[model samples]
Each structure stands twice: as C-alpha cells, then as structure tokens.
Target: MTTSIAQPSQTKQPQHVDPAKKRPKVLIAGGGLGGLSLGMLLQQTDIPYEIFERATEPKALGSAIALSAATDALFKQCNIYDEFVSLGKKTLSLQVIANEQRRVDYKMDFSAQQQVLGAIGHVIARPALHDLLFRQIPKNRMHMGKKILSTDDQGDNGITVTFSDGTTASGDILIGADGAYSAVRQNLFKRLKAHNKLPAADDVPLPYSTVCLVGQTRPLDPAVFPHLLQDDCQFINTLGENKPWAQGTVCWSIIRFVEESKTSTDDKNGHSIVDQEWGPEAAEAMCNEVRHFPVVSGNEVNPLTLGDLIDYTPKDLISKVKLEEIVFETWFGGRTVLMGDARPLNPAGGVGCQNAMHDAIILANWINALPSDPTSKDIENAFRSYQDERLPWIQTASNSTRFYRTMASGGIVAGLLRFCAKHMPAWAKRKMLVVLGGNRPQCSFLPLVEDKGSVPPAFQPSLLATKPKTPATSV
Candidate 1:
C-alpha cells in the first residue's frame, strides 16, 4: 500500500514580500543535493540565486538515502512530500548480521517512528532524490559546467566568483554548497589564511578512515529477488569479520575501514587518496575485489553473489568515495559562507545528505531574514547566526557518525558496542530514536505544517528568530 501524505501544490509560485526592496542575488557553488535544495527553498522567496556545477552533465552517483522526520516538515512546506513518498520505500526495521558467522546479531525496529515522530522514514535511491530536488528548481537558475575557481567578497560592493572559463558572476553573497572537496571552501580558506584568520583545524586536510563503493541496481525482477516484492524496505547490514559491507533494498555499499595512516595515501581499490574520482575504471577495480563476496540477504535457494548485483547495476551509477567526518570551526568569513558537505559526515551513518539539506533549510531561513541593501556586518551576522544554530547539532551528528563507524568497522571495540546496542533497553532506544528524529525544521516564511507527533520538534532558533511579527493593534 502506498503511504498517504497531505498533498500541496508542488509547483507553488514564488511569493515576493516587498517589490520596492531589492533582495540579495546569491551565487551558489555546486549543484548537488544541498545546493539544489537551497535553490528550491529560495525559489519560494524573493531571493535570486544561481547554482554552478562543475560536471558537464549529471552523474547518477552513490546509492540509497533514508529520508527521516528531521526534514519531513521542510518537504511538506516545499509541497513535494507526496512525490517524495511515492519515490521512496518506507523502512520498518534494520537487521544486523555477522557475515562470516551467518548469525543475526540484532534487529533495530523503527515502527515507533510514525507513532512518536509522525513520519516513518523511507529509503530512496540517491539519484531519485537528487532528481526530485532538481525538479523543484528552474533550469535557468542551474548552470552546469561552470566550476567555481575563486571568489572575492567585495566588501560593500558584495561578492564575485570567477569560473574556470574565466567568466565571472557577481552577487550580494556567495554560498559554498559544494561537496567535501569544495572549490568555494578552498578559496574562502585561502583568503582566511592570507589574513591569518583561518582556524588551525580548518587549515588541515579533511581526514577519513573509511572508503566506500556504493551503487543501486536497475529495478530487479521480484521473482529473482523476493525481498523487492515487500511493501517496506528491507535493510540487511552485515559486519564482516575483517572488512564490512551492507545491502539495502536495492542499493548496496562495500565499506572498508582503513588505518589513519593508510587513508592519506592509497587504498587497495586503486582509487587515489582524497581526490575520489568516480569512473568505470576505479569502480570496476573495487567491484572485482568484492564480487566474489556472498550476498547473504538475497535469495535463499539460488543465493546471489555481490557479482550478480554488480552486474545488475548500470556502470554509470556506481561511485567510490572516502567517508570523511569533520565539522570545521570556521563556517564563514566575510560575505562568503559554507554549507552541506563543505563539512561532511561519515556516510556509514547515512545522515550526511540529510544534514546537508537540513543545513540548507536553516541557512535559507537565516538568509531570508536579511534586509534589502544590507551592510557587510548584516551579511556576516546572518551567516554567524546560521552557524551558531547548526554547529551544536552538527557536532552531535559527527559524534553519532563516529559511533556508527565504530560499530560497523569491526574490532574488539565494535563487537562490544554492537553487543551493547543489541541488548540496549527499549526505553533508552526510544529516547535515542527521538533524539535522532526530533528536529523537524521548516521554512520560516512559508505556511507551517501542523505538528502531530507526540514528541515535539527540537527548538529551532532560526525559525523563532525569523517568524513573522504580529502587528500591534491600534488602541
């Protein structure tokens, strides 16, 4: 049965607040999920924004994505909640198994998510979600093949960004919504270092301990993979004795955790360090290594191998990426600011993209608060507020990602942690679930979705600060 959600006009026309006041023209670097989501949110406002993507064409990279209650309201406010549900498969439970031993470790039940949080999360393919966000944005606003080479905050004159083709675009503000190796972030940090204002932590290279090979197969035949027939998504995660991998409903990932020293140089997959170039050659190398590995979750009688699934997936959809977890101390300097994977989380947790889109929501709310012809201080203040509101949550998320990494990476510590998690009390588990699902931020300027969950949403300072002011009644 399909999930029923309130239907709002997905293509709601832009609502301008004040025609006399000129809003800021935003230059957004990167046309990934976060940037696209931000552009979609900005579309509902008077803000004029343009998205720059380095890729000449879109690549259907990565694997599955779980959309949780944290951004349920934001989707609803954007009026794309129904379509998101249609494209996604609701996940009820997660089964963790010991791969070599062929024993079920524990199952994480998420049935309470709907009752307590009002929205049980769904697992959708990354490309599907990316396309969904892309649909909400106008084609003209999104510029492909324009790589952001550098940016300059022109003080009172606003900001200007130079492209790889030597073309330039000037705007009131520049937002780095680029991925982990963001060019906008690189330029901003360079400027900060020149002025001796860059933080010690921000100056260092992004560190990672794990690399992942992820992909989603073309729609499978239900007779061959019976789990595909199930109404809810089947998430079967396995902790290998040595290396770890996980298989979702359709998407799968082979995660190999490396020593810190090994992370900086190279991996067995032949993919270069840091510069995670995703192409057929690199992905084929990793696929060959894990192809022989048995897929315990698919088909009992026939027993499919990882090779079968790899063959099932299109070559273009596969991607290999280093799972980097870090929250930079410096978020903004001058009129240039950063968001999304500019500060990424370990993909092991699957919350990185969610947090990126959430960052867009919060940042959009703050940006929407800026006045026409605002001063440099005004722009800085808005960016500061966005960071202050998101930093604590990101720190919490980073710690959570590390814990997930420890659990999935496998070792004495992981075993103990997995054991503890397996036997964790129900009430404690519920509390943790609440913590994970609680923050449901919406666009402050849009009509609010009614809160129906028993658990109230976490306090959003951006929403409260930018809420519409009530007019005073004349005596």
Candidate 2:
C-alpha cells in the first residue's frame, strides 16, 4: 500500500492573547521524531503547542529505525499503527553471523513470539517514518530553520525562548526534544549548577569505544542475498571478536527492503520525493573497513562480503558515527524537560527511536492531564512525574544496549551467551523470546491502547479525572 503525504493546508492562526491570560503553551525545541510525535499527540488532544526544527526543511538523514511493540502501541494510540505498519518490512528473525567463514552463531525467530506477544518489530527507513509524521503536523505549528539559542523560565510568566534569528517566543512550558548536545538542557543545568542543584557528572560525555557505519542498498535481489529476503528474516548482523587491528566487538547491521523504491515523481507515499545525495568520502572509508567482512545465506553456495553490500548501496545514503551511551541523571527542571536523544542511551539495541517515541507519548499524556490553567508548580509536578516514570526504564534500556554491545564483542561472556543461544532447547528459546517480546512498556490511555500485559507498568494517568478549573495563568 502506497501512503501519500498530504500537503499541509493553511489555516487561520488563533488570535494572540496576553501572556498573562493564555493557557499553558508547550514550546518544543528540535522538531525530530520525538518533538513531532509529541506535537501529534498534543494536536490529537487539542492542546496548544508548537514544534521548532533547526533545519530548513524535513530531511530523513539517518538509516533504518526498528520499532518494537512498545512503540507500535504509541502508533496505535495515535490511530496510525496500521499506516505505520504498511510503510515498513516486518522483522521476524535475527541472525548473528560470525567470523570470515560466515558461520551463524546465534539466531532468534520472532514469528511464534509475535503471535504470543501480539506485536512484531518492523524496520523502516528513517525518512519514510519522518515524512509520515511530518505530513500530519499543521504547517503553521511546525517552525523550520528556527534554531533555539536559549531558554528562560520567567517564574510566574512562563518560559521565554530566543532563537538564532533574534526573535522570541514564550510558552507556559518548554520541552528540550533537541537531541544530545541540547541547548535547553545546557541552560537549565547552568542555572541549576549556579544554585548548587546540578550533579557534577551530568555534563560529561558518555564513553564510547565502537564506531558504526550504516547505509541502505537499492531493492535487494533475492538471488544475491536470499537470507535477507526470507519470510522469517529482516536483518543480519556479522559479529567479530576483539583483535589487535580492531578494538572492541566489530559488528555490522545489514537491513534489507527497509523502504520501497521511489518513483521519479513520488515516494512510496504519493508526496514528491526530496533528493538527498550522499558523498563518496564516507562510503569509501566505510568500504575500506569492512571490505573483507563476510555474510552468509542458507541457500547460497558461497558467502558475500561487506564490499558487495557497499557496492550496491548508493553513495549518498551512507552514514558513519561513533556509538556512545549516556543517560542523563535529570530529565527536567522547573518547566523545561528533555526527551529522546536529548536524554541519551546506548544505540546497540536499536531502541533509541522507540524509546524517544515512548517518552513523547508519556510526556504528552502527563501534560494533557494538567489543569486548564496550570500553575508553575503544577507544571513542575508533571515534569517530575514524567521523569520519575521514565528514568528507570530508560536506564534499563541503556544498560541492555551496553550489555548487548559487550556480548557482541568477543569475550568469555560473549562466548557463553552465543553458546547458550545456539544450543538452548527449543522450548527454552521460545520462552526467552516470549519474555523478551512480552515485557515492554505500553501507553495507558484513551482508545485503550492494549498489548500483552506481560510488560512493565507504564504511566497510566487518570484519564477520567478532570483538570482543575483555575483561572488562566502563565508559568
């Protein structure tokens, strides 16, 4: 099914009101996935909000994003789960291939688990998902190229934000969906440190020893990579042990058919395609590193090399980055809060995007629960509640990613894990898969976003409770 991106229709702006008389206005910085998802939720709830992106226009710049059941639940709450599923390939199994011979060390089949858990993972191109979210947002509410310079909490008046262009916008609450190096976080911490409230280690970068290169090949021919095209497979990972030549576990995540091919006039979605070209320098460097890396298919007589995958990939789509892990100790202060990569996590498990979307859903739910004319204290309580509910899960996710990275890196523990995964009884493996797939945080609000209750407790704000009917006031 081809999903068409509808052009945003222009609508008259709401009349400007005095800052003192306006209801709580949400000022979201960084219009990436988290910000846009939050904006969509706010729009659904009829809450006043705006999203700001530093870029001139929406450009899907990253590689593929894997959506877990937790994230799928958020999509369902927004009534877009089916549309979202239609845009990506269902990921049913994961194969961990090892060494130059392309031997399969461990495999996880998710088909049966999907049946048991009621949700299966999907791997989609980042741009397609971004475009899907972008189309639903109101044009006037999404401000492009507006880089947020700094934010000020104006006590009873709310928060004031200044952008790179010297203009100013004020809102009752501010959200720092702005990624890792967030200006909102920086400013908030500066003030907190001045007041002796900031933690000493909160400002440093998380340590990282792994480098990752991600890219997509054109529509893959089954004959070339049959394993990737199989009904029960979506991604293949080649894991290597530590060597003198390469430090840590060197791993490659090879994803296929993440997005459908684009036509000259439109994307799989009927919207006009925005051309994003990749340069050769990065691709050349990546190809040099993994030229001899091997990948195997059950049907093929011989294994394929990483160089072969690169050869088929368009040069412009390749991206390289160092994999780092950082989970902030604090997520909010006063009326300003952080979401998504701004909160930080290890990328090993490919759950960063899912977690970010989860943050948006939970935060939006809390904000929507606030009174019609919430006080600064009311907003602060909501921020605290949002952080308190999400921090433990975020930390768990970070630790899981770090642990996976360690297991992928050849070590005594990695060997043990691989052996267990390979030799475990079928019943035990299915039980483990059921546990892994079943235990995920879910959204708890309207439309009864139901999934397997085997997961952890999600923040379920009292939907039936009415907001306080206080006089309209600023932050």
Candidate 3:
C-alpha cells in the first residue's frame, strides 16, 4: 500500500459548526448503500446529517448484493427491514454445480453465490435496498445534485465541505462514506502526505479473473430461491473446465437477480440511477461475451423488467472485476477518517458494503456513547475506539479475502480449478463452505449472527432470517 500526497487545493480553511448543538451536524459524501444506511442510522439518533450526492438522482449501479445476517441487525435497528421485504426476493437454498454435476445443495442463505457458505444473508437487488433506505430517509435531508469538491477538517472542532457549485456547508464532523474512488479520501491522502505519515510504495497488480454481469430475473421455475431461504444462505458454484478451483477458490460465482430499476422514468428521460444500470441490449452484449449460463441471475430478471421489448438499446456499460490494490494505503488520517469502499476497498469476500456499514454502526454508536457535553478528547476517544474496535478484523478480512480471491481466480493460471473440480470429493466443497462462509479466519469480528447470537424475546426464524450480511471489513 502506497500513499502519496497530492497538492492541496488553495482553498480556504474549513469554518466550524457549533459543537454545542444537541445533534452534531455531520456531512456524508456519496449516496450509495453506505451513505444512505449511515444517514438512516443517524436519523434514529440525535445526530443530524447532510448527505451530499454527486449524482442528480438515486441510481442502482452494479447488480444484486447479499446482505449478511450480521449487517441486517443494523438495518433492523433503523426500522427499515419490513420495507426491504417488499422489494427483495427471499433466498433460501444452497446448490453447487460443476458442469452438470450438483456438488452440494445444502440449506443456506446467499445460496446463489458459490463463494458464500455459512453466514446466511439475503441476496437482494441493489435498487430495492436503495429504494427502501431512500424512502425511510427524511426527504428534506437529501441534497441530490451537490458534488463535493473539497473538504477540510479544521481539527479544532469541525469539518467544512465545499461543493463544486461554490456553495459550502460546515459540520461538526465529516464521515467519508464515499465509494472506492473517493474524493474525501483523496483529500486525506494529501493531508497525510503533508503531515508525512503515509505508507511506502508496495502496490502491484493482482492477477485474477472474475468477469461478472448484473441484471435481474424472477426465481427459478419451482421457486428455487425458496430452498435457499430454508437455511442461512445458498451458494451455487460452477467449476469450469479451465477455470480456477480450490477449497475456497471461487472463479465463476454469480450473484443472481439482486439489482433492479424501480422506475423507468429516469432512463426514459436523461435522469438515471448509477452510471452502471444496463438495459436489455447491453446485458445481452455482456451475455454474448461472458457466455450465457442456464439463465443466470441477470438473464432472468432482464426479461421481467424489459417485457415485450426484445432488445434493449445500449446505455449502461458492464465490465469485468479487474483491479490491482485490494486494500488502500491509508483509510483515515487526522480529523478525516475514511469508511466504505473508501476504507478497505477489498474486491472480493463480499466485505465492501460490510466494512462500510460497520463503519457507520461502530462510529455512530461510539459518538452517541460519548458524554453529552463532549470535549475534543471525547471526539478523539470515539475515533480511536472506532479504529481500535473495527480495524483488526477489517485488516484481517482485507488480507484474507484478497488472498482467497487471488487463489480461486488464479486456478487457471496455476492449473488448479480443473484438476480439483474433477478430483476433489464432494465433502471438500462442504468443508470449504464452512471455512469460506463460517468462522472465516480473517473476519471473526463479524459473528455468524449479530447481537452475539442472542435470540430476541420473540424468536421467529422469519424475523431472524430476514437479516442481510453484516458489516464486511474487506469492503
């Protein structure tokens, strides 16, 4: 991990927000799941926040994501789980496939993703979850088109964020919930370089192959997803002839139908979701290249959304998951701390959103835990506690997941996937799931279930099962 200082902008220093206010003003950048979730969580608390989103509208980029049971606790706490129920499909089975052979069809959640094994979660469409969170958020709190151009943490008492449009807002604190390509994190990198505290150059290209496509479709003919709902998560892996394979090796894994466009009004006009929402034609292009499997997640959902329209015109661009750094050099420095993809930035292990949400959960709790009339030391203590409590597992999950993805995706390069898929016994797959999904060495911080496995006073599997994957440190 290498962190370098970019020249700081010749901008004015940040003005301070009144720290004595009962609800500290917080500025959140980026409006993805992390930003929205953070905002929703804070709303329940006394913390008032201003969420800044560069995009003019809310768009679901990428595809579906499986929220682990642990992360779902935070959602439930925010009181939006029921809203998600209407938008998401309840997955309940785990089935593994290699060519035509069914390797393991265990009862589990996230069964659709072969990479996951133990921790049961809901593999939901990004749009659905986004809508749920957006709906729950107080409409007045959102500033849709404001793009943050620069941020300055005064270090005295607050941070000030300036938008590209020349408007400025000051907050008692700034939470960098921005995505992987984060501007706030970039500013922190520059600040760290100014203070001379970043890591040295050690980043190199990681060789792996995982070209994924994101679209939506209905569940299988007899409702195959219901079977996965039976357990925690369901994962189906297809070990290709020349693809990668290992106990935890995951080369060809699919996320199934987890993303959707709630309204076509955005697309019909110029307004849209994320820049990545693909219509039918672009999805077809991806299928034409990625090789169409037996109605993988996207293929099925595309038809449902684009009915009677045989072909979709091109707009959204779909691409492979090719990257170099799984972890960034410095996530936070001084008064500015990075969270979400801007934090760990792991490509695999389904940790990105997890890490981001955990950032919110731990940070919000820490601040709220502080004395009502808190001091700078109180703020600093909260910051330190957030890092100390969350950093260890995040570090471990980042290294572990990166290593896991490297090995699984490297099966082709190292001549492992094909050999193991053909020779490895069925029992090996089950054991792999235990390690990959349950009791993962890197992410002990994330318990299989949240709340230390404490059953609520009203113990209901459906209520308990509605949880999504908890905060992933790797994200």
Off by over 4 Å in 2: 1-22, 241-283, 297-303, 425-445, 452-475
Best by TM-score: 1
Top of the candidates by lDDT: 1
Which ranges in model 1 have alpha carbons more than 4 Å from their true place? 1-10, 101-103, 261-279, 472-475
lDDT of 1 by residue, 1-475 (tens): 1122333435556786678988888888988999998999999988889999999977778788877777788788888887888878988888887775445668988888887888888888788788788878787888999987678788999988888899999999899988887788888888889899998987766678787899888878777788777888888886666755767446888888876623334344222354534455777898898887766545777877788888988887787877766789999988988999988788767788889888999889988999878888999999999999989888888888888878887568988988888888889788988888888888898899988788988899999999778799998
**What ranking emerges by lDDT with the best candidate at the front?**
1, 2, 3
Give the clash count for each candidate. Answer: 0, 2, 42
lDDT of each: 0.81, 0.66, 0.50
RMSD of each: 3.6, 9.3, 12.8
Candidate 3, residues 1-475, lDDT tens digits: the string is: 0011222212212122345656556788888888877776666555667888889988745545655545656655554555554444444543444442334423233342333332345655565567666765676788888877787877756778899999998876677776645678766665666677766541222222333444333233323223323322233444444432211111122322112212222232222233443345555554554342331222333412121111221234232232223455555555566677665343455666666776776666665555554555666666776676666657766775655454344235424543454455656755544433332111111222344322221122222322233676873
Per-residue alpha-carbon lDDT of model 2 for 1-475, expressed as tens digits?
0123544422323323335444578999988888888887777654689888888978645667777655776677666777787777677766766665566656666666555566778877777788878776888799998887777898877899999999888989999988765678878887787788888877454454555566666666566666554443246666654421111011234321111222223333222232332235654655676667665644456556666766776766666554445777878888899999877665667778888887887787688777668888998898888887777778778777767655565668877876776777878866755544443544333455556534333434433233333488899
Model 3 score (lDDT): 0.50
